[model samples]
Target: MTALTTLGLGPLIPLGEALPPPEVAWRLALVGVGMGLHGGPTQALVLGAAPPGRAATAASTLQLSRPLGFALGPVPAAAVWGLAGQAHGVRAGIAFAATAAGPAVPLLTLRRQPSTTAG
Candidate 1:
């Protein structure tokens, strides 16, 4: 669900160019909603799945990855934008972002195995 919402962002962003200010604002708000829906469940899943004694490490790693992803995500997008040329740069970059989300779809289908340790 979260991946699908994120996948929608790339196509939605470019539409802002042709949309009025109010329309763009609402779409951006929707993006925020999508992000909010993903964040908590993701954190919970990570924390819940951590080894019994490694919750702190799992949490810290998760925190670190968020910023790293944010910082690194644009690198490829920018490269795509540059390669595409100014005329279509923004759209190409956004399209690249959409493609990047593709892998998450399959990943989301994975189920966590039941813990072998007895309570």
Candidate 2:
């Protein structure tokens, strides 16, 4: 999911000209689909991994990450763009965003709880 969200922007970096309207729409739709695909698994993982009594805190924190990233992550991207111009700077930003997911991916995968069996 994180990979999908970050890497989805990759193709844009290499484009030499503004995309046609249909292509723009198609890419936006793919991003939307990627985001839609992200929600369920993330919710399940965050809520499920809550230690005994911290479910609400866990869920809230999970929810908070999005806005926090939105609020903070763009600063460096903008800085890079200011320094390097659009193509290289945006590539730097995209690379940073994609690599940022690397640490979190292992953590998410580690919580494979066994299914409960009915008595």
Candidate 3:
């Protein structure tokens, strides 16, 4: 889902005035839906896989990566955008995101186990 969204977004950037406003709106809407679907399950999986005793810490640590990525991502993206120029910047950014996301997909496949009570 994440990979698809990242890949889908690149071409959408260049659609511009070629697409009807309604069609563009729907495509962006689908991307948002894909993001939301991906986000919730990923969070649950990360938290569920954590050591029971340290689950809270694990969740907190997991949450930290997001803002850190946001803080760090734009600098390099901006560099690529500046170098690539407006006509191609969006495609470069999309390619960068997809490449970064590719490896993480394999790591995300974790088998679920039945819950164990600590008491």
List the candidate 2 regions with Cα displacement exceeding 4 Å.
16-24, 101-107, 112-119
Residue pairs of candidate 2 with colliding backbone atoms: none
Pairs clashing within candidate 3: none
Q: What's the lDDT for all of these models? A: 0.73, 0.66, 0.68
**Lowest lDDT 10-mer window, candidate 2?**
10-19
lDDT, candidate 3, 87-115, per-residue tens: 77766765565566566666667586878
**Candidate 2 residue lDDT tens string, 33-99:** 7667887898888787777699999988989996787699768766766677765665566556555
lDDT of 2 at 96: 60
- Highest TM-score: give the candidate number: 1
Worst lDDT window (10 residues) for model 1?
8-17
lDDT of 3 at 92: 72
Assess the local accuracy of residue 118 in candidate 3 as a C-alpha lDDT between 0 and 100. 100
Model 3, residue 42: distance off in Å is: 1.8
Candidate 1 deviant stretches above 4 angstroms: 13-23, 115-119
